[model samples]
Target chain A: MNHKELIADIAGKIDLTKTEVEHLLDIIVDVCCEQLEGRGSIGMQSFGVFDVKKREERLTVHPTTQKRMMIPPKLTVNFKQSSILKDKLKNVPS
Target chain B: MNHKELIADIAGKIDLTKTEVEHLLDIIVDVCCEQLEGRGSIGMQSFGVFDVKKREERLTVHPTTQKRMMIPPKLTVNFKQSSILKDKLKNVPS
Candidate 1:
């Protein structure tokens, strides 16, 4: 599902208009980004946590060219699902 | 930040009340979980993608006990940040 489909799904599930839902999502993203940008994590109960972690600078060889290169350290966003969600997903048909 | 703090932040940013923001978050979680449970993925523009991936059953030995055990195959939720988010995260002080 894409953004529009997700907004429609949430809007249908509650007493909110599509525009309102979209706005809510936009703000949610903004808030989460702000938190992550500051090296903070967002933990939503029964959902998951979003965090920012730094990757150390490292040397690597290019796969095709087999050339050595230096990769600069950078921050990354990561998400880990809550245990409640994990339990719910345990029985998903493989 | 926990769920309530996040809701507060979002409410402060938008015109919505705290209760409404919380309800919206609940519904959003429900919808996302439903999509993931069905082995589907959710893609939000400028945010990130939530995906469900299956892990093949495997065998591993306990670290201390050194006893081998079988690990059942299960579904897991994974998130990958969008390039826009990644770009924003790049300059984060490491």
Candidate 2:
């Protein structure tokens, strides 16, 4: 599902219009980004946690060129499924 | 941040009350999970994508007992950050 579909699905379940749901989604994304950019995490019970992890710089050599290069340390966002969600997924026949 | 604090933060930024925001969040979570439970994905432009991945069952040895065991296959949720968000994070000083 894309953004529009997700928004429509959400709006359909609630009393808000599509536009209002879209706005709400945008705000939620903004808030999440702000929190993650600060290296913090967002935890929702029975849902999951969104966290920011920093990958340390490392040295690697090109496979073909055989040249060494430095990879700068960078930040990344990770989502860990909550145990509750994990259990729910486990219960589904794979 | 915890769910309550996150909800309050979002509520403060929008016209919606805390209760309304909480309800909205719940529906969003539910929709996302529903999509994921079907092994589908949700893509939010300039934000990221949430996908369901399946890890094949594997055999492993117990560390202390040295006994072999079978690990069941499981479904997991993964979030891949968008390049826009990655760039934004890169701009932040480490």
Candidate 3:
């Protein structure tokens, strides 16, 4: 489902209008992004954890040119599914 | 940040109260989990994609006993970040 559809679904589940739900979602995304940019992590008890992972600088050979280069260390967002969601997805009984 | 703190952050940015924000966040999580359980995927334009991936059953050996075993096929929640979020995370000027 796309953003609108997802928001509509959530709106259906709760007593909120679609627009209000959309705005809230946007705010959630913005807050999460800002937190990640500030080098923080967010954890949802039932969903998962979203955090920034730092990659180490490493030497790598170019696949085509065969030239070795040093790739700078960088940050990327990572997520680990929570056990609740995992069990739900796998349909395994806890 | 924990769920409460994150919701508080979002609440500060938007008009919603902290409690309302928490409720919305919960609704979001519930909807997403239901979607995944229903074998569906959710895409947020500015954030990322959440989808369920199916793992095929495979044969593997236990390292300790060296006994062969079959791993059952299962479902997992996977996420792929959007370019917008990735660029923000990498600080790429685009």
Candidate 4:
């Protein structure tokens, strides 16, 4: 499901209109980006934690030309599934 | 930030009341969970993708006891950040 579908599905289940759900989703993404950029993390019960991790600069060689490229350090968004969520997923029948 | 804090923050930025934001967040989490449970994936631009991955059962040796453990096959929730989010995080100065 894409963003629109998610919003639509969620809106159907909740008491909010499509527009409200859309705005809520937009705000959520915006807030998460801002918080992560500010070095803050988000934690939700039974879901997961969204964190910003610092990655060091690294050198990579081009696969085709054998040329080296230097990648700069950057912050990365990392999500760790909660044990509850993990358990819930793991128990699903194949 | 925790769930409450997230709801509070997002509510402050949007026109929705705190209660509405809280409900919206709850629905978002619920819908995502249900979709993942059903082996569906959710993707959002400039954010990330939430997917369900099947993990095969594996044998692992205990670190200190020299015992082998059998990990059962299970589903896992995987999140892949979008390229736009990645670059935004990468450009942050150390």
Task: Report lDDT (CA) for all predictions.
Answer: 0.91, 0.92, 0.84, 0.85
Q: Model 2, residue A25: what's the lDDT? A: 93
Q: Provide the lowest-lDDT 10-residue window in model 4 chain A.
A: A85-94
lDDT of 4 by residue, A1-94 (tens): 9989998898899778888878778778988988887888999877899998888899999999999999977777888888977877765777
Best by lDDT: 2
What is the Cα-based lDDT of residue B33 in candidate 1?
94
Q: Give the distance in Å from residue B75's predicted Cα in candidate 1 to where it truly belongs.
A: 1.0
lDDT of 1 by residue, B1-94 (tens): 9999999999999887999888888889999999999999999988999999888999999999999999999888999999999998987878
DockQ of each: 0.87, 0.82, 0.53, 0.71
Q: Cα miss at A61, model 3 (Å)?
A: 5.4
The per-prediction tally of clashing pairs is 0, 0, 0, 0
TM-score of chain B of 4: 0.90
Candidate 1 CA-lDDT value:
0.91
Candidate 2 lDDT score at position B64: 100
Write model 2 residue lDDT over B1-94, tens digit each, in one string.
Answer: 9999999999999998999899889999999988888888999878899998889999999999999999999999999999989998997787
Q: Compared with the true structure, what per-residue lDDT tens digits does model 4 show for residues B1-94?
A: 9988988898889877998777767778888888888889999878999998888999999999999999988787888899988777765766
When superposed on Cα atoms, how far off is each prediction in RMSD? 1.2, 1.0, 3.4, 1.9
lDDT of 2 by residue, A1-94 (tens): 9999999999899998999999889999999899988888999877999998889999999999999999989999889999988988997777
lDDT of 3 at B10: 83
Error of 2 at B85 (Å): 1.1
